[model samples]
Target: MTRLYSQPPRIDAGLFFLRFTGCLLLLHVHGLPKIFHFSEELTHIEDPFGLGPWVSLLSAIVAEVICPLFILVGAFTRLACLPIIAVLLVAMLFVHPDWSIAEGQFGWLLLIIFTTLAIAGPGRWRVGASQSREVRYGAG
Candidate 1:
């Protein structure tokens, strides 16, 4: 039977690349703006669930800014992805359901990237990875 996976080093490298690039794009495009322009974002953020604008904007900041930082460093990556995924899902599905695929391509693409990371994890290149390995596989 054919091998189902690449070598460890290659897989780790790919995971790191995906995490780094995806998180970086999210941080740069969405996270920083929400941070630097807090008041402006407050004015425009969608309150899809009628939770109020402050709650909505704060939720977005947590997901886009704080969560990406965790994912970027490969710590609690799967857990971190949950908020990002939730926020993107809300934005795409609830807040902007009228957007055509072309109009919403970026959000959809980010969803794909983060969803992939959530499934694949940060691989062996992650922070505390050695500790996890030692625990899971026994000391080598």
Candidate 2:
């Protein structure tokens, strides 16, 4: 008979799927465009905190581009999610507070995904998978 329980491998696979899909969607839709069209992105970049457009864009690039890259590889996965969560919160809650749920669904969904990953860690099947266990469960 086939088992229908969450085995370690199955859980790890699920985590990988979540990380891969979330990071891929974030990178392809938001991150890469920032790099490929830096000039255009700069013109309309939001400066919600009055940090200046350059600082805002660079911050977004780091959270959206660089951090996602780190999470994708499972390097500092939990730490990487913090910046993304912060950026998403700022964008959804502060920058575009007027956006209804329908309009901000994407950002909200990304928030949920990253938050889950942050709590769950990258799971096995990641680079330095064993180390991930140590970090999550504590070094022995």
Q: Which residue pairs in candidate 1 collide?
A: none
- lDDT for each residue of candidate 2 in 1-140, tens digit (9 for 90 to 100): 34333336788889999999999999999999999999999999999999899999999999999999899888999999999999999999899999999999999999999999999998877876663233233233
**For residues 1-140, could you state the per-residue lDDT of candidate 1 as single tens digits?**
33333346788889999999999999999999999999999998889899999999999999999999999889999999999999999999999999999999999999999999999888888877773342233243
Task: Provide C-alpha RMSD values for all models, in order.
Answer: 4.3, 5.4
Worst 10 residues of 1 by lDDT: 131-140
Off by over 4 Å in 2: 1-7, 131-140
**The candidate that achieves the highest lDDT relative to the unseen native structure:** 2
Cα deviation of 123 in candidate 1 (Å)? Answer: 0.6
Per-prediction count of colliding residue pairs?
0, 0
Q: Report the lDDT of model 1 for residue 59.
A: 93
